[model samples]
Target: MLHIWGRISSINVKKVVWTAQELGLNFQRTDAGGLFGIVKTPEYVRLNPNSTVPVIEDDDFVLWESNVIVRYLCAKHSAGQMYPTDLRARFDAERWMDWQQTTLNPASRPGFWQLIRTPAEQRNAAVIAESNAAVESLMATLDRHLAQRTYMAGEHFSMADIPLACEVHRWFGLPQPRQSRPNLERWYAGIRARQASKGVLDLALS
Candidate 1:
């Protein structure tokens, strides 16, 4: 059985959980990080020096980094299906995944931290406003891309959709102005329909 160490509320952790469920792999998830606090312990540190939620142990093989874990699982189990077999298709998926990490996550983090984690009294309105604007700008790019395709990489769902969907869910959960982006909304609706996203993506934002 695969063992996943992380709290369910973590967006990165949710990515792994959703992927494992999508692949129908039997997994045991142990709560760590945040209030759980096991991440600082030596045992957990040995697994991930970064002390982040979501470290996976597949038999004796230990893996950290959420996107890499998703890719490894998909390649190991679903290859030509979820992982994408064609060289171009595989890199397309990789491109979107990288975009999520480098572009979307940074633009959206401030708003999410201010609105969800920080108390309203202590929140910086300027930071929140700036972050929200950045996120919206990036979302516009996604909206345009999605206008032509059903999923991030192509028509069929693949590993590319998972991380980007998770990042979009974070942005959508913030209580900020959301301009109408029909294509982004349409793409999200499709993601919401997937059974594997039920306990992860469908939940209220933490």
Candidate 2:
């Protein structure tokens, strides 16, 4: 069985969990980061030096980085559908996986830290406002892409959808002025209907 070290509340961790379920891989999840505090322990740090949630041990092959884990699992178990087989299609699927890490996550991370991690009294109003604006700008980029395709990569549902789907949960759940992108909303609705998504990604923010 695959063993995952992370707290379920983490968006990154949630992405991996949902992907595993979608791929029908049996996995054991252990609480590690945030309130759990196990991520800092010597044993956990050996697996993930960054001390982040979502380090995984698949037998002897250890893996960290949530998006990489999603791709690895999809390639190992569900290629052609989830991971895709053609080089161009796979690259297209992977491009958005990288994009979420490079673009969307950075913009939203500050807002997540400010709103959820920092207590309201200790929060910096100016930073929070700026972070919210950054997230809006980042989302506009996604809206543009989603307008053309049902999924991030192309016509098919693939691993590309996983990372951004987790991010979308946060975007829709968060309170703020948001543009109504019908195509983006339609894409999200399709992912939300999946059984694995209902089990994992639909959980309330912690």
Best candidate (score: TM-score):
1
Q: How far is each candidate from the true structure, as Cα RMSD in Å? A: 0.7, 1.4
Off by over 4 Å in 2: none
lDDT per residue for candidate 1 within 94-201, as digits (tens), equals 999998988889888888999999998999999999998888899899999999999999899999999999998888888777898999999999998999999998
List of clashing residue pairs for candidate 1: none
Residue-level lDDT tens digits of model 2 in 1-206: 99988989999999999998888889999988888999888988899999998989999999999999999999999988898999999998888898889888888878777777788899888887887888877777888888988789888888999899999898787655677877788889998998888667677776
Candidate 1 lDDT at 173 equals: 82
Record all residue pairs in model 2 with backbone atoms less than 3 Å apart, i.e. clashing. Answer: none
Clashes of each: 0, 0
| TM-score for predicted model 2 compared with the true structure | 0.94
- Model 1 TM-score is 0.98
